[model samples]
Target: MLKEERYSVILDLINKKGILKVSDITDVIDVTEVTVRRDLQDLDQRGLLKRIHGGAQSTHPIKLEKELSHIEKKNLNLDSKIHIAKKIATTICDGDSIFLGPGTTIELVHDYLNVNNVKIVTNSIHVFNGFIDDPRYELILIGGSYRNKTGAFVGSIANDILSRINIDKAFIGVNAINDNTITNSNEDEGMIQTTILNNALEKYIVADSSKLNKRDFYQFYTLDKVTAIITDNNISPENIDKYSKYTKLYF
Candidate 1:
């Protein structure tokens, strides 16, 4: 088939399905893996689609009004989360006070922490539970109206408590980062994250590659406010160049 015909087929599949693997295109178009990859790369360069590790996803922003439950989000990008968690863990030092926000990616940071004499403040039940039995750390759980879906505490009470304390560092997660804004699915949760980030000496946003260029329901903060964005290495070079123009990125 001609390249133009192959492009049309590939674009139709991506538009309908939102994402398509190289093999998926190959199966339908009778093209080799190399040819499919070339097509995807060309389409990505033209801004028609986004090139991911093994697939091409739509470039359109994903606007989510409701977030996935904790269990559902835990395994979505497990390997990328693990890599980002390990990188974030190295930034913590002994005797430092930190704030951890709610999210599956942030929750994984607990497994890689090797620091001692650290104090942790959080509104996440999952985050609190991770360090509850550890002898070297002090854990403080912010209490408020609990959200069952995210396993987090979010309300005026949680915001009030967070406002009174200042921490050395804060690691917050988000539903999406699009253009210059960082957003969340819930307004209350976004307010709490904003409060913690504003009060901390250093602020970091933890997100995977998939969260880049996406949109959520509520805008809480901007890219310029954070110290840096810690993401996985799977982020495309084009995105790295684009986002890095606004803030630092640690992959």
Candidate 2:
């Protein structure tokens, strides 16, 4: 494809999908990672999209793109998720009540939780399945409509459940955050997440490096809503410093 055509395609990708990872663009455009990086640079220069560490996304109020299947997300950022997950694991106490969000990164929290006698509640079916059978943790699932693409429960039922439960710290997952806001790809899921955030004593958000400065459909809360955010090392120290003025940002 010509440079102009590729440019349009890149814009289209970001518009359709709230966030476009580097690999996702390369896969769609049949180009080298280096070539894709150049394309992203050009797009960012034109102010059509913002260049992230690993991808480009639209500059408009972020919206959910076509959601990915659970398997698709699980392996996308394995190492980064593991690092962020490990940090989150350390924050939990033996008897603390916690709520986990419906996100692949948040899924790692359940996978790594080996603590004895901890009560965990979630609207994530994958999270529930990961630990429901483990007798060491008291796993409670907030029943709601299942999103096949994400294997998460959201909507009214999930919102209702979150309202009734009290959690010490809720680990909310996010797709992107701008200066002051935390947003998600799915609108309905954002609604349920807001409920979880409102009820928790402390809320922690887990997202990898690529999500900073990006925005998506339906914001759940602002930076003040959470006590801290745990992200991968790839996030810029400059960005972390900017975010830290509002909330504790952990790498």
Candidate 3:
């Protein structure tokens, strides 16, 4: 491609990654090492980035909040997350034991599930109430301290209950996935989710395409931590290829 196009790609990478190694930019932009280095110099000189040892850090740092408003998560990708939720539900069969996490996507999964006789164990109060009262499904709510805002169980009791159960597949929620790690927005949620994943036979992280390749605070798992991902086709090809090395990626 053209040299100008390579520079445009560099800026896009910085926006997504928040930083980029010189060598990594070379690979991403498909330019010679010297050409990439010169492009970084131009960007750095223009006050776009602060040069680091091997990479350039964006002048715009990404800051993550502990709590995002329910509206924020719900509105992030209304249609794409709906598609992801549907794909996650389709993976299940009748009589499978499933672990559903607390998040909008998993709520969508719970909302979409017509699968019969699935024993769902979760600490998410929303997921509990979504199916708990229904006769078609069996709901197990792990007892623990409650998080009113997110409406999930937190602390030791939740962990203990998680340790005692075995699940066929876990429908997990992720805040972001970048730098090869699955991160969550809240620390306490990460703690509970880590325990949930440890006991499951297969794990599936259901996130909208917007969360893909975006790293935020509090990593709960890595790319290799889960078996597969259910997301929409909005994912960047670069990221899909990057994560595919570790897990099966499905839309």
Candidate 4:
């Protein structure tokens, strides 16, 4: 595997398990102990984690929103995102007006859409690009202050546009999911997501397994607000039971 791929997997493992030994990481990935230690050190220097005696741990609860480049995020959780997007596409129908929030997972939903004469409303430039050249769909790009890194529109303008329209469904993405509450990092981004949910007749929180059982900075909406959630098959049966109490779930 490439060095960067190893780094991403190691970071994901640390985040999920809280701490990991060098031997454990090497066992999971096809890398040696020497290489794992070096990778950990590199991630430590980048402030992604904290290196310790024999392993590494997460830095802290990310309370503040960190704007990462879209390119970087697009490469993370790719397989899970693709699976979730395919599941989401199964629900779309012709002549449907849907709201999609900004996230790499949500962006992939565009690929599996097979319907024609569909109208898509979104604040994500990445989401917009997927349908920009296709005439089968009508695209509505919500305008506002641009967040360059995320390629998303935020602020009052985006919210106002969302308020004026009533969508058939809203496929929202989130940074973290803790218990029954769904959250994101930035307050501005959270506001736009929340507003879209409020205006939609049906709301679907589209996320991957990595986002579950964790909490981010801003709590936008709870599971009760949505009609259902669409996640990847990797979600555990334990989580399915916990989240099912609040809303219907699909993979």
**lDDT (C-alpha, whole model) for all candidates:** 0.90, 0.83, 0.80, 0.86
In candidate 1, position 46 carries an lDDT of 96
RMSD of 3: 5.2
RMSD of 1: 11.2
Can you tell me which runs of candidate 2 are displaced by over 4 Å? 1-66
* Candidate 4 RMSD computed on C-alpha atoms after optimal superposition onto the true structure: 12.2
- The prediction achieving the highest TM-score against the true structure is 1
Task: Give candidate 3 regions above 4 Å deviation.
Answer: 1-61
Per-residue accuracy of model 1 over 157-249 as CA lDDT, tens digit each: 999999999999999999888766798899999999999999999999999989987778888999988899999999999999979988999
lDDT, model 3, position 35: 82
Clashing pairs in 2: 62-216, 62-217
Clashing pairs in 1: none
Candidate 2: minimum summed lDDT over ten consecutive residues — where? 60-69
lDDT sort, best first: 1, 4, 2, 3
Per-residue lDDT of candidate 2, residues 139-225 (tens digit): 888877888877778888778767888889999888887777788878888888888888899989888878887777677889976
Model 4 lDDT-worst window of ten: 60-69
